[model samples]
Target: MKQLYYAALIYLVLGLAGGLGYREITKANGFTGDTQLAVVHTHLLVLGMLVFLVVLLLEKTFTLTDSRLFPWFFWVYNAGVVWTAAFLAINGTRTVAGEPTGAALAGMAGFGHILLTAGLVLFFVCLRSRLSTSDTAPTTTIGR
Candidate 1:
């Protein structure tokens, strides 16, 4: 959990820096149009920050005993995020350069999105089930 928290914070800082640097570069080049930097920023937030936090929270809050599904979910979710972010970054670069959108790129992006969404859904369902179990107690008191 601590590692994930640190990773999320680092990613957030990096994302901000990347966004600002990209903006500066675009401005310096006098190019006012689509930029892959936007995609990079979005990916940094979605994959690095959001996904990292979610997984970290689950690990810290839930107890997995002899459950294989949790490990599978972790790998699938992280892989999906990585692939989606990479594809988006590549596509974004092409789009920013005024290049034609090829069928391969489109398909990759679509597939990546689907995988990421599916992974997120699976993780959510698992987390929800774990949270609803009678063995897990609420963190806060009702009267407090």
Candidate 2:
């Protein structure tokens, strides 16, 4: 889980660098338009960094009874995020390049977002069930 968290953080940093590089190159080329850098930044921070960290924390804090779901949730959510980020980056680049709009690309981005949302919801549900079933016993200290 720590490794996954670090990997997601690395991707977030890379996304930042990519956005900044795009801006610099565009500015140097004297190109200006609505490239949606804000969207890219938000997506990177939320989906890439925030979501992955949350998953890691959840894994560490809870002992899931049904461990079978963990791998499914992890893979689906990560894949969804990666797909979304990749498509958004491509779309942003194409928009900046003044290329013809592709419906398939837009659809891919939308599908990825949907996948991510679904994965997160499923993960939360699983976690909630496990936590509720666990016994919460009060702790006592002998010294006290």
Candidate 3:
């Protein structure tokens, strides 16, 4: 949980910094044609920061620490997001600068997507196990 919290904070910084950095790069370079770099910040926020934060909070509602899959999901998901963001930055800059993106970058990005899908499946599996257990304690019980 602490690790996840730290990861989320890191992503928050990365997302904000990435957004500002990409924006300044475009502005300074007079890039008005294609701005795929625009999504750099969004991807970090949504896939990295937001997802981790949600998982951390879910830990409070459910015993995520007990799961065999949560740790794997956490690491795999972060790796995929990082890989995807790196390529997004690279290809986005290339596109904005009117350079050709080679096949290697595209292949790497596709691999990242595949990893992201696998991580999501693990997350869902962890969530289903927690929900299916009747002995699981509710963080907020409403009924009297």
Candidate 4:
């Protein structure tokens, strides 16, 4: 749970930076169209920060980190976020600067998506395991 909390905080910083970076960089470049950079901040906020915060709550109720798959989910999901964000920054900057784009960055982004999907599957498996093993304690009941 502490890990999740920390991860969320870290991502919050990164997300803010991403949004600011996108705006300033675009303005500086005098670019006026949409680019992959636009979504980077939202992705970091939703996937990296918000998801981890939610999982921290889930961990309190379901003890999700107890599962063998939890660590895998953590690492893989983070890797995906980082990979995807890096690609967006790189490709987006190139596009903004009127540089030719390449397929390699797209390929890397696709792989990041794969990692994210795998991480989600693992999270669900851990969730299901917890669901089957025990009932939620009323004290920890969410949305009360």
Highest TM-score: give the candidate number. 4
lDDT of 1 by residue, 3-64 (tens): 66876887687667667766766666666777555776777787878777877766765753
Cα lDDT of model 3 by residue, 1-144, tens digit:
898899999999999999998989898889887666899899999999999889899888776768899888888888899999999899888887788999998889888888899999999999888877736555576895
Q: lDDT of each structure?
A: 0.68, 0.73, 0.87, 0.90
Each candidate structure's TM-score, on Cα atoms with residue i matched to residue i, is 0.69, 0.79, 0.88, 0.91
Q: Model 2, range 31-126, lDDT digits (tens) per residue?
A: 687664436666777777877777677667675425667666777777787778778778877777677658998999999988898878778777
Candidate 1: list runs displaced more than 4 Å.
6-10, 13-21, 24-29, 64-67, 132-144
Shift in Å, residue 85, candidate 2: 1.0
Model 2: lDDT to the true structure: 0.73
Worst 10 residues of 4 by lDDT: 132-141
Write down the TM-score for model 2.
Answer: 0.79
Query: What TM-score, to 2 decimals, does candidate 4 have?
Result: 0.91
Candidate with maximal lDDT: 4
Which candidate would rank higher by TM-score, 2 or 3? 3
Where is the poorest 10-residue window by lDDT in model 1?
Answer: 63-72
After superposition, candidate 4 runs with Cα above 4 Å error: 136-144
Q: What is the Å distance of residue 33 in model 2 from its true position? A: 1.8
The RMSD (Cα, Å) of candidate 1 is 4.1
Show pairs that collide, candidate 3: none
